[model samples]
Target: MTVESPAGPSTGTSTGRRWHVLGAWLLADALALTGTRLAAVALPWLALTTTGSPTAAGVVAFAELAPLVVAKVLSGPAIDHLGARRVAVGCDAASASTVAAIPALHHLDALSFPALLVLVAATGALRGPADAARHSLVPVLAESTRQPMERVTGLASTVERTSSLVGAALAAGLVALVGAADALAVNAAGLALAAVVLGLGARSVGRGVPADDDPHSYLVRLRAGWQFLRRDPVILALTVMIAFTNLLDVAFTAVLLPVWAVETGSGVGAVGLLLAVMAATSVVGSLVAAAWADRMPRFAVYVVAFVVCGLPRFAVLAWSDVTSAPVVVMAVAGLASGFLNPVVGAVFFERIPRHLVGRVGAMSTAVAWGLMPFGGLVGSALLALLDLRAALLVAGVLYLVTTLAPVVDRRFRAMDRVPVEVS
Candidate 1:
């Protein structure tokens, strides 16, 4: 278990700890994601309860997410130049301070809406780079431990899902017991702890560009990342496809599902139950992927998982009246969805050169998530133009088409090839 650092065993420090780096990275990632999920719930709730205006709450959300996406797109070069470990530690520490300010200011009766907005926005901006840096660490950590990328990314995905489930529940309980402001303080504490864990344990990993490496200007490095993505058909296609699917997912979760619940007389509780079921099953799926995904064909698994996880839920919601049908569909879909991230993560790590991981990964992620903010708007528009059932049907068809891209396009065949750095 005594694995060498990227610089090899000559560094004279890799012989003592077994899996400490990977363990610390996972723990840090879990803590950070949990804090994020807590904020996702607490921030909007605080805005709504304090301002008593839904529009103000919406504005707060927009303020946070818009900057986050922009920052992710721009932070890639910084991550590559300064190193993932440094950037992640710095951003998380800054995020902790910024998040702590919200509760502190509110307790003193001095937290205005505008000030709250700025704080939330700062946390969001910091989060973008923090997240990208963490993602860039997976490949390095996997190599250091001599572990397969599928296993590492699958574990990461599982940690992500588990943290989200736990964090949302925790946020709700904390908000109910002590209010959103106090819940936010707990979030700040989690982030600060994550920073400490990562800074101390991951010192040898993600050490950034070497001094002897080419020192390209920031803009040139950024452009090089974009150009690489544009030339690589597989990653580019995956980016576009995932972006559209993300939009549809947001639409389904944010608008369609709730509207369906109301129209079907299932109530809000049923909506929560359905999502809970999906998330739980998805965790199980991630575990399976973590164990066996490396043995499976990446292309086939990716295609099948997307198909299962995408169109079926929409189809079930649009067409079925049986109470148990949607639940069953969600369980199946969640299980299938679990295999997705591991496969995609392995492909990206296998294909992208180590030097460009930060820039390429950041740009790809930013693009994939860029459509999410508009998802609710798109769903609302769909409902405006079509009936509920019809809108669901349309969304389902779109998802089906998007997921089938891999099967139709030959470029995705490269997913099955041996790992080779794209230079």
Candidate 2:
């Protein structure tokens, strides 16, 4: 059962230590993502309540996400040069400080709208690198453990779903008890703890490819990643498809869902509750993917999952008046969505060389998220021109069309190819 290791030959000691690293990585990811999910709920609500305008809320979202995308794009060289573990630890610490400032300034009554935007933007910038570094650790960790990428990615997705479930519930309770401003303190703590845990445990892993022998400039390395990405038809297609889908997703979560809650008189609690339901069901789907995804046809599974998750949830929200109906639809959608990352991640990691993973992965992720900064603006603009239901239906149709790309394009069939080990 021996598999090639990226760092070196797989020894018994290294194999055992890989489990430790994997556990630490997953735990840190959970903590950091939980904090992020809380902020995701708190920040929009804070903006909405404070400004009393959806446009203002959209502006606040744009302030954060625009810097985030830029930071992610620029972070590729630093990650390849400095190592993923170091970058992750440093960025997480910075993110904690920035996030803490939001609550501190709000409490002091010094948090102007502009000041709030500044803090949010700083947090987003730091978080982009931290997230990219963390994601780049996955393939190396997978190789070390001698596990299929699908299993490790599935486990990661399960952790993500569980964290979302916990984070959403905690956000509801915190917002109820302390309001949105103070609930952010919990997020700060989580980020700080993640920094500590990962810094301590993943020190020996994630060193990335050493550059001592290579004579390439940083820009050259960065350009290499971009060139490879553009040349690969499969990855290129995935990036374009995911970019559009991510834009739609951000719109749904950040703007559309919040507006729906408010308009339905459901309050912030219901928003948190619905998100929790989706995350909870998603955990089940992730578990199933972790266990059986390697045996399945990736392209078929991906298509089916996308079909199930993409348009139905929006349709339910748009058409249904019953509280229970949307919840049920969201649960089903979440379950389908859980299989997505594992399938996509395995294909992505399989194609990229170990040496280029940091730069390539970051570039791909940056492109995939490039349009997200405008997602809130798009949702807000739709709301201005059309009613809430009309906006939802419009977005849903767009989503359906976007998700159909894999079926229409032959390149995506490469996802089902047997992956050659990329050392």
lDDT of each: 0.81, 0.88
The residue ranges of model 1 lying beyond 4 angstroms of the native Cα positions read 1-10, 15-18, 41-61, 102-117, 175-182, 206-209, 212-215, 255-273, 315-326, 383-393, 419-421
**Model 1, residue 2: displacement in angstroms?**
26
> Least lDDT summed over 10 consecutive residues: which range in candidate 1?
1-10
Candidate 2: tens digits of C-alpha lDDT, residues 1-423: 222223444454566687998999999999999999998889888999998888877888888889998899889878766778889899999999999998899889999999999999999999999999999888888878889999999999999999999999889889989999899999999999999999998766744345444577777878988998998888899999999998888788888889998998888888898899999999999999999999999999998898889898788889865569989988999999999988888888889887778888999999999999999999899999999999999999999999998988999998888556533
TM-score of 2: 0.96
> Could you tell me the TM-score of candidate 1?
0.86
- Per-residue lDDT of 279 in model 1: 71
Candidate 1 clash pair list: none
lDDT of 2 at 49: 91
> Which stretches of candidate 2 lie above 4 Å from their native place?
1-14, 206-213, 419-423
- Error of model 1, residue 265, in angstroms: 8.0
Tally clashing residue pairs in candidate 2: 0
- Local error of candidate 2 at residue 16 (angstroms): 3.2
**Mind giving the per-residue lDDT tens digits that candidate 1 earns over 1-423?**
222223233245463453787888899999998888777666656765676544454566666766777899999888777788889899999999999998899889999999998898898899889999899888877776678999999999998877766776677577778888888888898899899999998777744245425566788889988998899888988888899998898677656775677579775445556766677788888999999999999899999999999999999999875559999999899899889999899888888887788899999988888887676567777887898899999999999999999888998988888654567
lDDT of model 1 at position 421: 52
